[model samples]
Structure formats: structure tokens, C-alpha cells
Target: KIKNWLSAPDSSRNMNEAYGKLQDGTCSWFFEGEQFSTWKEEPSFLWVKGKGKFLLVSLSSIIHNVDLAKQDSSLSMAYFFFDGRDSQTELQLHHKLIRSLIWQLSYREDHKVPLPLVNLYKKYGHQQPLDRVLRDRSFRWIALQIEELKKCASKNEIQKKLGKLPRGLDETYQRILKGIDRDYWDDTKIFLQFLAFSKRPLKVDELAEVITVDLGSEEGPAFIEDKQYQDPRIVLTRCSSLFLLLYLLNKTSGIIKLSHFSVKEYLLSPMLTKELFMSDAAFTNWVQLWNIDLNIWDQKRSRDKTDVMKMASALYYASLAGIKPTVELLLTNKAEVNAQGGWWGNALQAASAECHRDIVELLLVNKADVNAQGGDYGNALQAASFHGHRDIVELLLQNKAEVNAQGGYHGNALQAASARGYKYNVELLLINEAAVNAEGGYHGNALQAASAEGHRDIVELLLQNKAEVNAQGGEYGNALQAASFHGHRDIVELLLQNKAEVNAQGGEYQNALQAASAGGHRNIVELLLQNKAEVNAQGGYYGNALQAASTGGHRDIVELLLQNKAEVNAQGGYYGNALKAASHWGHRDIVELLLQNKADVNAQGGEYGNALQAASFHGHRDIVELLLVNKAEVNAQGGEYGNALQAASAEGHMDIMELLQEKDAINEDHKEEFSTE
Candidate 1:
């Protein structure tokens, strides 16, 4: 429970896994380097800088040496591998570094949790379960504060360069590319494209198998028996600098990966513009041929489901890329034209979305389901409509595509066309009876979609077509609130003129006034207020206009809300009240203003419980001092981390923690004196 509560990343486990794969004498040359000796002797930083194929393996050896030195000694050691492939959160990447280091230092020897950690756990453990409470607010707050530390660490670092090495990785990669044998150049290009454009890292055998099959042959994707390498490892030897073991999964069966992400970047980039990498047209042709051939090969190998998926994916991509020849070839090879896969679903939808007129015609000729609903924009018509592909929309409509079909991101063709401000597409869809008052998708109805995007012409067109102006749904509820929130003053006024409800509460920001205030649209706020908008309407992400304005650091908007009788002591939203929101976000002027307006300094609700705790947790020392001076309750406890001290402790905000401690001690002394009196 405690270990889980600590929330240290499992990078130590990753380190161990990599370390276990390290060969005994690998990177032995690094140990003999002068800078390595200096690093071992000194407390100062020594960066082992290189663009070598074996950098990861070398680092593993160094970590192993560090671990060996720490054995049976008082020395503490911690190491973490930063894998760029993993989508680590800001808290996990930055703050977890500090947490993991502290956890390691405190508990590495004999696995005992330090007294401070235990005290922290005990302090908040009673409020909720150890895991939930530890993570609730503390991690995010600490992560934000540690951003400065990350920036500082990035500054003025010394890097030890290897002697006689190429100054940059690009230069090294260039030389390696040039060094590939002339005989193997064509094969190597095919080998690299398979790696570069592959969905995931291909295994060594898989790569070899693909390379053995010749797609450009007159016989069509024939296997060259003599060209096959006996051992899978020999395939890697042909591409020297590009084939280092990129973190093996086990001893025998290793999953192959690019030497580095930069290798792929270099291959795809224009800097290496040579015969090594094919042009867009050539690459598309290659890919189309390869996909078709690979599918047949996979089918022969008895992997029918996987092969069909691959074929469908290829057809979708070929259509999407607007490659006529590729699409024709794919279809010729019996690629499923109506295959339900990829972002835009079928080949027809993909081609339509990208405005590939010829391909759309080709697909329709092949009897693709014109109204097929499955992808990002639902049907081919919706996809074409959303992307402003008028020609494709016309084509789909001519072929009996459904205009009022509701499914995708923008709901239907009408809504999609409206959101994108495609007037012609909107008109075309409307002409085809697209259900003008359609309600669904990201923006609910066409009017609100148009209004949200500030498409006034579309808004007018919709209204003129008797589109429901007050129809509620989508991100901003009604058109008026959407217009007001987006700061489209003209649209807001127009919607108001159309009798669109000003205080119509629904969607993300609840109503126009609060949305306008949150977005810092003072003119819109003023306009809404003039049109009888409710000043104290609550129910958005922020409780009310005043809280929203304060949270957004909109001083002018905050002042306007205050003048309009906005509540200062309102208890709702992420931070409970305007004061706490302002404090947490480091809006000192707004904090001061809220305090002046008699906002509760000891208000206990929201994420950090009180204004002082919110400020303390986020490292707002000035706000903490100001709140303390304004007589914020020092002992108040009930939100994320119990009290201000605990909040400060969670983030290691020493200055705020000390200030809180002094105030708590002073309050205790005063209590004692009062009791005696």
C-alpha cells in the first residue's frame, strides 16, 4: 500500500530489464576514458555525450558500474531511463523524477520508509485511501512547481565529446548511409522504408522476409530465393550504423526497432534527399505494390484476418494520399473498396474526404457503399462536406449519399459543413434535404456549430432556412452562448436579434455571461449583460462569471463582474471560490482584489480545501504571505492534502512551508496566552 502510495515510476524496473541484457565486456572502452575517471572522482556533472549506435548499451554499463560501487556501501544511487516512446505525463516525467529519487534515497537500503514519508502518509491516509489521496492534488501541484527546476537543469550543462567523432549525429548518419555497398543500395532502401513507414517496429525475420520479396519484378512480387539471408542477424549487418539492439525483450527473440527516432526523422527529412529515400509518388507506388503483394503473401502463409486488415489499411491510405495509380492498382489487386477501417473508414470515404475526384469516381464505379457510416466524418458525404470538398459532395449526392446521416464528429453533413463555414457545401446539403435543424455531433446543430466557429454567413443562412436558433446541444449549448464565448460580437448581437436566449444554460460554460467572462471577452460580457444576461448564473467548469474571470487572470473582466454584483464568496468550481482559483493560479492582483471585496480567506472547499493551501501547494509564496496576512485560517483542514502545511510539504515549497510553520507556531502561542489570561 505504501509503495503504491509513493507513486514512484516503474523506471527502476525498466533499468533492471535493460541492465540484465548488458554483455559482460560491452562498453569496457568507456571505463578507460579520462572523463569517466574524472566523473568517478568528482561531485561535478560529467555528461557522456555521443551519437554512437551503442549509447543505450553504454549507459546500461555505466549504471551497472554505479550499482556495483553502491553494494555494501553507504552510498545511495538512483537511475531512470527516459523512453521518448512512452507517453509520460508532465507529472510522471518531471515531478516523478524528484519523488523517485527521494523514495530511493529514503528506502533503498533495508527498504524502510523514511519518517518524513511515513508522517506525510499518516497525515493524509485517514482522509481517503493511500493511493487516491496521494495522487488527487499533490502530484499535479508538485509537477507544476518542478518545471522551474527542469528549466534550470537544462541551463549551462557541460558535455564530454568523444575525440575524433563526427560533431553531429546527422553527419554520422550521412556517412553511414553513403557507406552502404552499391550492390545492396536498392535492397537497403526497401529495408529502410519497411522500418520507416511500418506501423510498429518489425522483427528481424519479418524485415528479412519482406526484403526477400521483390515487388517491382515483372512477375509481380516474386521471392528471390538466392537473396535470402540464412541468419536473421545478417540482415542487420547490411545496414551498419542503423542496426544496434534497441532494447531487447529477451535473450533469443528480440523485437527490432530503429537505432533512434532521429534515424527515422533523417530518412523522412529532405536533408537526406537522395536515391536512398524515394519521392512521394515513388514511395506511394512502392507502398501500394508492397501492400498488395504482402497481403497475398500473408494469405499464402495462412494469416487471412491480418492480411485482410493490412489490405484494407493500404486501400484507405492509398485513397487518402490521392494517388490515382496506387488506388487503381489496389482495386485491380481486389482490395476491398468498401472496407471498414482506417480514420475515414472505407476507401470511398477516404478518397471523398481528401477530394480525390477521379478516385471517388473509380470507387463508385467499383460499387462502394456511398452512404456507408463508420469513420471520422460518418459517411462519404459528411467527410466530403466537413472538408469543404464540394466536388466530392456533389459526386456523393449524385450517387445517392445520405446528407442527414448522423454519426461522426460533426454529427451529419449539414453540421460538418456548417462548422467548417463551407457555404456551397451547406447549400448543396440543404438542397438535398439535410434536415436543417439537425441536432447531434460536436456542435449539436448547424446554427450552434456556425455560431461557435463565428461563421456569421452560415449562421444567417441557417436562420434564414428556419434553423432553430435556440436549439440546445453540442459544446456550447445554444448558438448565442457559443457566439458570446468565442467573442464573435457581431454573431452574439445577431443571435440576440434572432431572439436566441441570453442566459440559456447548458454545455461547457453553462451560459453566455460565464463563458464570455472565462474567455476574457469583455465586450461580449458587457453586451450579454446589456441584453439581460444573468450575472450570477452558475453550473459551468467555473462556478460563476466572477470565478471564471478570476481563474483566467482577466482583471478587467473580474472588475466588470464585481461591478455587476457577482458573488465573491461563491463556493463551487475546481477551486471552490474566486479567491482560491486566483491564488492557485498566481493571480496576486486578483487575489488582492478578492480579499478587498471581503472574499473568505478561510474558505474550505475545492481541490486544495482553502485559498492558502491552494497557493501554498502551487508555490505561490507571495499569495501565501498575503493570505496569511489577511488572516487565512492556518489550521483549516479538509480538501486534497488536509492543510496548507501538508500542501506545501507535498510540493517541497520550503519558503511557503516555513511561513506556514511560523504562523502555526504563533497561533499556538497566542492560544496558550489567551488560556492563561
Candidate 2:
């Protein structure tokens, strides 16, 4: 059902089709709330009877607009403020906000006043310590306090600064911190958000290196290089602010499985995460799930500088250590696994194809859809097979991968293994009974593959197991054709013993014998002949085995045919005779052999006329003279010797023309003109 929906034409539908929770049109379980009895229909509200929390459930895209995200911020007291942060000015702004919040608390009546706010007022005096203020409130308040602290200029000038600070949470946090006088968020969220970004994980050396930024003293790094800098900490803290949060929530790679194009659109429209975090079971669940954004499967998102910077950071850690929380931090649960149109697909497919085992494993363990179609790459199995990572294949298979999954220039694991001659992988697929004749590339099945590569052991294994004896596919007809085409005599013999079709037709040539003869494989031809393979099978556009042998230059086989009571003057093919083909290819030895076999000399060849004409076309003047000596008619049209003088002059064969002219039997009127007309 998920596959059918994911591969559907409806782009406007919700793309979170890959998630198991979404199995019933919607997955409405949450953490921090009570558990439900069972799956329910589209209920408007969920009552967590134990937790005293009323969960509102809605089905929508997780991605929300940043402009619209402002709505979520409305509930926070310290919402992002548009102002500049200076010591004296921030003091003024803080004093004013303090007065307003204090007035609201003193009234004890402002519905806008939150319970946490009233509680904070009762706990902390009217002038709460700056350190205590930052620690007690939500991130929203911290952001507001940072801004209030950074009101560096007069009210008139604050807007100018806001105009210059850029329009995101990082800048918003930056503005707030510019004048912060209180404590920062707890050190744990700090370490988790920022240190995890570096993937350094607060090593002793790093923890030892601290830099400070004075709230009033925005000097160079040297001002407090040794001290744990407030500014740097703020930088780290603000890195996970709303803008950072959204960026983190939205940054998906090919491995991530996108649930929707817009994070807030897919996640919040339905209040999905709120529900997930509402229930302990949903949050604690360790199930593997894929995010499928079928709605925007083909949409391309232009990555901004932040995206690149984030990716660089992710890749850096990936190269040195391995993918940790970086993939999770950058991409959301709603990000697509097979995200096609970003900078790249989720990180796993890229890493796996490049043989980055660690990343592949990381992604797999993190619930990255192992079977998702990767960007430009077909799927994870294709990647593993192409790289011949036997272990990766094992991992994907363990994850329930489709064995014959098609992808790459040649589709599926079987074809890739066959092409690369990975005998063990071939055996794995064969033992597992992979699609026997799954056509991808020229070698479709394991039999043709083993035979083409002369894997005699593999061929014997496949044949004994009833693998297709003649699975005609791709360029070669089947196992017999591939072996005979490449002249694998041993493999050919084994196939025939297994009842392999001898007269099996193949690419550009009708049968295995024809292919062998065309390639001048004398041993293969002899073996096929011993099996009583057709000597005159005329199924190809190029005609029979005799013609294939003659054109490609095989003298021993030509004699063998004659000795075996083979017809020497079998006139078939575009090229009329065997001798014509031999002379056309300048096989003087073969031509002589054919002549000794009483072959027809005046037979026309493919685009080369008869034997003497074919010889003249190839500039074999010595052979031409030989043909003339054999009572070849000088005026035989289409033969190179037809007009002996004309043929000689065309090739500048002055000596041959002189010899021909010296013979009174040769007419001087036979001009040595090169003109075909």
C-alpha cells in the first residue's frame, strides 16, 4: 500500500506515506501524554486521561512556513524582538520589559500572562538576577532577553539594526545575545545542540579551550581567549534557535526519506510531533520507519549557504569519525528517505555507493529506509552490488531488501555480480534463486555470465542445478552464445554436454556456431562441429557459418569443413562465397586453402565484389596476381581483376598492370581506371 501510494500520480497528497504510523491514513500517537486504546478514526481531539493533557490531532504537512512560524512564537514572552543590543540601551529595554511583565503580574489578571511567568515572578523578586532570568524561562524568553540586552542604540536606531541583522532565528538570537546580562540556557542543551554539531562531543582538549565575549566589550578573540567566552557560548546556544531549529528540522539527505517538502507544513499542520512527544510509548518506540514525501518527490530545493555549510560540517564529521546525530540533527523525521531534489539524497546512499561502510550502517541503524531509491542511484542494494560489498549486501538483505531490485546502467544485484564476475555473489543469488533471466545489460542470467567469463566451475554449478542452458538475452543469445562468441571452448563443451542449444540464435549472428566462426574461434567452432552443430545454419543477417568463417579468416576450420564432407561452394550470404570473404580480409593463407579446396574464385563479397576484387579493394596485389594466374577471367565484372588495368591503377599496382599487359591474353583496353562507374 505504501509503495503504491508513494509511486502514485497524486502530488498534492501528503507524502509521509512511508511511515508505519501513517498506515491508517494518519499516525496519531504521541509522547508526554497518555496511551490510546487502539488506532482510531480521524478524531478531532485525543484525551490523555492520565496526563490531564488534551491533544489536538490534525493531519497535515510537517513543514511550515517561517513567516507562519511566527504564530508558534506568539505564546512566548521573550518572542524574537526587532532591536539592537547595546549595554546602556539593553538596560533600558530590559527595565521597560521588566516593568510591563511586572505590571502584568501585579494585576494578576492579564490573560496573556502565562502560569510560568507568574510563577517566575513569585520566585524571583521584581529585579531578578540576570543569571537567574536566562536559566528559568523557555528558549523563547532567552531569545527575548538576549534582544532586550542588545538594545545597543536608541529606539529610533534599533529598527535600523534589526533591518541589518538578517531575518532569521540565528540573527534574532544574535541580536538578543548582543546585550544579554543574564545566565544562558542549561549547559546540557548547549552541549547536545552545538557540541554534537561539531561531533567532537566535548573532548577534554576542546573543553579546555574557551573564549569569552564581554557583554559590553565586543573586542577581538584575544580579549578573553583563555576564559569560557559568553559570546561563543551564545553563538553555540543560538545555533539551535528557531532559525537553526527549522534549518535542522528541514535539512534532509537522500537517505532521510522526506515526509513533506515543508517541515512545518507536514509536521505542525497536523500537530504531529506534539502528539508524538505527548505519549511515552510513541516517543520511546525504536521502530524503523521511512519518511516518504510523494507529494514533492520530483521537486527540487535550492540549497542555501546555510545548507552547504551544514552539509560540509556533516561530511567533515562523517569523514573523520562517522555519522552521528548530525544526520538526525540536520534532517527531520519527516524528511524524505529517497529525497531526489536536494543537494544530494540522504547521506547513506551517497556514502554506501562510495563504499563508506560506516555511514551506510549509521543510516541503516538510524532507520534510514534501506530500500529507498537513491538519488540518481537506483537503490541501496544496487549501490552495494555495484561496489561488490558483500557485507553491505548482507546488511540490506537482513533489512528485508528486494533481491532483484533494478538500478544503475545494468539493473539489479544479479546483473551487477554477473558483469563483475563476482562468483560468490552469483552463487549467493543463484542459491537464493534470484530471477534466472532478469534482463539487465548484455549478460542477463548467471549462466551466460559464467560462460562469457569462462567461469567453468560456475558454469558446471549452474548447469548441474538446471540453470537455463540457452537463456537467450542481451547481445549474446544465451550461455552457449556468450561462450562461443568469446571462444570459451571448455565452457562451450560443458554446455553442449548439458543439452545446451547449439543452433541458438544470437546478436548480429543467428547461432552460437555463426558467432564463433565470425570471431574466428577455431577451437569453439571445432567443439560445436563435433556436437554436429549446424554448419550451414543461415539464420543471421550475415548468412551461414561458412561465410562467417571466411570473412573473419579461419583457414584450419575451412579445411576441417572440407574434410568433414562440408560443401565448399555453398553460395549464401551478402558476400557470395567463402573465398571472396577470405580475400576481402587479406587472409592470403586462407584464400590459398580455399582455392586448394576448389572454392569458387569469382564469388562476390560484402561491398567487395568477388575474391580477386575483394583482394584488390584490400590492396592485396600479390594475391590479385595469384588469382590472375589461376585463370581468373580479367574481364569478370565486379571482381577486382575484372578490368585488371583499372584495378591495378586504382591501387597504383603498376607492376601488376605491367605483368597483366605483358600477357597478350590480357587486353590493354582493360584500362587501370579507379572509377567504380
Candidate 3:
């Protein structure tokens, strides 16, 4: 279920359709040619350049040979052949290709699906039906999951097989239609009509349910549930070769689509059009029966004509749904295609964000602004790149989108792409002259964003593009500190290799060493120490690495810092010193270790002047006793509460107050004896 729901259905039928007609040894010329030999020998993409209808047929032979050769070996192979005859299928051609490849490569000896795919399924599967799970957003999400896969060679070249004249196609389709049982004529016609004009592919269950809707009933259109087929699979038998079942993994019934555009053309022919119920009128009836508004899917359309935002929302939503006709209708009615107020700002950004490549092109052609800045991503390019929509990103770039236009949560397209780990988008943006080190956003710059997000490949790419590794300004300051704070040890090493300054200070944790210590990442701490990070560097909330570690109760880290000769009495942060931080935080073990390392018992400099006062104010009696035993002044003056006695009294710690009083009394008696002497 996980694999099937998450991956594209296998393209075996498409491959078989191409392979079945080939003569066994016909493609030997290409295999023996230099192009094939070079591609096989090197680990690079093979572009079989040519200009003819026979090119695809020959390529199919090569794919089959490669598949057979790679089987049962360490090498794995996946292939997709694009057919552009059907405009509807072509809308999702890239999706089908990517999904098919993902499914093919996911197979393993243990038969376990990859964790990322499983997680994607868990997130989007139960929230919607299986047919609805492969929408634009989720498709982009899964594509980004394995964008690092080997490059695939593709062509928009038409195949001669599907380009046959209408006469031959009409006869082949007509015979299949005539062979259907007379009893199944009405249902079969409705099925064929649905496939011929549906917005997207329909699942068997959905089509079966749609067939039960009585649009011409005396009572307004309603689903006659009793009219539904007992078994949805029966629809396949009714249509035969005219339709194809795209079965997903682990499922019996699957999506139903036309076998070819020729079948659609035959169905919509002058002679069969009326019989198959294929017409704009039939689609209108469907729209009415399904309760869908033709102009917009949104129910919150503006009641008042003057409300521009609400009026513009219709166009935005129409674009978002990838309903080209609705978008056209709204645009024809003077809808604001460049209106800037929605989750995605405008029609162009919404379309771009959702991977609606055609709609994006439509809007751009309709004069939609390419660089109008607003909303979550600021502009279309950033939104497209952030969501891993490479086609849309390229479209936006080609339309003159400012690659360095900064304003969104991610600041610019490069940072947005980098943060999301969309390396392909990042590469595309870099190639288009995006400022790799351009600053201003949540993660400061592209390198910091990639590093903070643990996208090593993106980090490497940014570095190769000359990204500043030690550049500061985000939540984690620089790339190295971000990686360290996030416990990304490998990224930390990479940043170091790029000459990231180990002691560069400026974020919430000041330096990588302090950030690592505060995060309790011992391995990163060791790495930083090896790179000569200043152990006693002071400037963040916790003063130094030792204080930060102590405050976090990271005893192991504190011990490591002490062994590294960290100043036990280093003072300059909130809790004054390491002992004061540990005592106030109730880390008795760390306090003991700090004291043993000779941390000044009476060091005064932070919110709590001394360790005793800090422990007393917090009512950590065990820590208080430990501090007292270490000879911390019982009446130490100066701190938030003035002294240990007053600090304990203010917090209403009776046991601590009494202990402090007794210690004070002992000191007083000693003072009197000394005065008498």
C-alpha cells in the first residue's frame, strides 16, 4: 500500500506497447553505434539525437536491451516514454515519468519502501482519496525527495504510431465500440464520454459513481445510488481496448483513461459524437450535476461587484485548481490576474506554487506580473523554486523575474530553494545569476539556509558557486554554527572544509562551539575543539560554552569542556559563571564537577552574583548544600536577591533559610572569637 500509494504506476503497458511491434535484431545498428557504446561506458546521460519517426522505436529497443542487461546485477534501470498525442495526459507527462521512475527504483531485497516515500504517504494518503493524493503539491514534494537521481533523457518528438490518419483510427475504434454488448451501450457511452472530456483521469470508483448521477431527472440532478454498478471492475469489460486501467500498486481497481487520443477522436467524430454523448452540453450537465461553478471553484465569490479582493480571489482560485477554462472565463470577464492578496499573493504565484505549468504560462501570456512581490514567497520565482517546480521556475526566469528580488520569508529564490533542499531549482537559479551570497531572510543567506536545513548537496552547490561560508546574520549566525546547532556533523565538517571560521560569533549561541555545547552535541563539540574553536569565547545568552553546557544540564559536555581547560570561573552571561549557571539550574552533578575544577565559589557577575545566591533563590536545596560545602559565602552580598540569606527568605525556602542562618551564626561566633583574641 505504501509503495503503490506513493509511487507512479509502472509503465510496463506503455513499454510493452512500444516493444511489441519491434523486430528482435532491428535496433542492432544503434547498439553497435558509437553513441550507445560511449553512453554505456561512461556515467553520463546519453542523448540519442536524430530527426525521424523511427527514432522512438529504436530508442525503445535500446531501453529493452539495457533493462535485460542490468537485471539481477548491481545496476538498476528505469524508463519512461512520453506520448504527446493526448493533451490531457501531456499535462501530467513529467509527473508520470518521475513517479514511474520513483516506483521502479524503490524496490529492494527486503521489499521495504524508502522512509521518505513512506512518510509522504503517511502525510497525504489518509487525508484524501488515492486518486486525489497525486495533486500538484504532493507530486512536487515527492519529486524533490529524489531530485538527485540520475538525469533522464527525454524528447517531445512525436511517434509515427500515434500519428495515423483519422480513417484508419476511426475504423479500429468503431469495431471495438460495435463489439460491446447491446445491454452495456448506455453505460459504455457515458464511460467513454467521461474519459473523452474529464478534467483529469477518473478512478473506476469515481466514474462508476458519476454514471449513477441522473442529470435529466424531474427532480434536479441527484445521484441514484441504487443505479451504481455492483462491481466497478465491470466497467473495464464494457469498454475493452478503448480504455486502459492504470492500476496502482496493491490495488485492484485503478484509474480509467482512454487508450489513446485516437479513441477520443473517434468517439467525438461526427457519426459517434451524439451516440457517445460527447459535447459541451454534456460537460455542462456534468458541471451542474457535480454542483461545480463554471467560473470558479470557490464558494466565497464576492457578493458585491466592487469588492476587488473578493472578486480577484475567483481568478486566484481558478488558477490554483488548474482549471484552464475557468481561468479563461474569469480573465475574459476582466478578473485581476495580477491581484496581490491571497495565500500565494496573485494568480501567477498561486499557479506557479502548485506546479500548474500551463496555467502559469496562460497567466504570464495574459500579462500577469512576473516579479510582483507580496505574500508568503514574495514572487512567482521564489514560490516555484521553494516548491521544487523547476518548469515553473524556468518559465518565470525566462520571463525576466529578478533572481535576486528579496522579500519573502526565505528572502530570495536561491535561499528559498536552498532551504527546501531543492538542488535542481538551486542549480537553475545559480545558472540564471542568482546572488549566491545575497542576504536577508530567516536563514540570512543561501549557504546558511542550506546548512541549517541540513541540505549538504545544496550547501556544496552554494559553496561551488562561491557562497560565503562564514557570512553571519541568521538564527544560527553562519553556516558552520547553523550546522553545529542543528547537530548536522557532516555539514559542519563540510563548512569547515570550505574554511568557515570556527570562532566567528554572531547568532543566538554566538559561536559554533557554544551552539554545539548548548545543543549537547558532544561529537560536534569535539570536532569544533579539534578545529581550534575558542573554548572560553564569551558573548551569547549563556556567557561561554561551559556555562551554556552547564545551564542545559549537559554534564558530559561540561566534563569535556573542563578537560579541554575551559575556564571554570569564566563570567559574562546570565547566570554569572559556570557554577552559578549549574547551581541555579539545579544541575547538582555539573555544579559539583565545576567546583572540583576550582570554579570560584563566590564569583559575582551575572543575574545571580554568586553560586550560593543563585542556588538559594532557585530553592535548589541540594545545590545550595553542595555550594555551602564548597565554602560558598553563606551571606554573600550582591546578586538579584542581594545575599544567600535574603535570597532563600524571599523564595520562602524555610529549610534553606535555616541552613543559611546557622552558617551565618557560625561565622558570627568565629568573628567574635577573633575580635576577643
Cα TM-score per model: 0.63, 0.47, 0.55
lDDT of 1 at 98: 75
| Candidate 3 wrong stretches, greater than 4 Å | 1-312, 321-323, 644-677
lDDT of 1 by residue, 342-416 (tens): 667788888887689999999999889998989767888888887788998998889988778888877899988
Give the alpha carbon lDDT tens digit for every residue of 589-666 in model 2.
777887787876765545555666566545666777778777666556654345545555666656656655555324
**RMSD from true fold, candidate 3:** 21.4
Model 1: colliding residue pairs:
none
Better of 2 and 3 by lDDT: 3
Model 1, TM vs. native: 0.63
TM-score of 2: 0.47
Question: Model 1, stretches more than 4 Å misplaced?
Answer: 1-178, 181-189, 192-209, 212-237, 240-313, 665-677
Lowest-lDDT window of 10 residues in candidate 2?
11-20
Candidate-wise lDDT, in order: 0.73, 0.50, 0.73
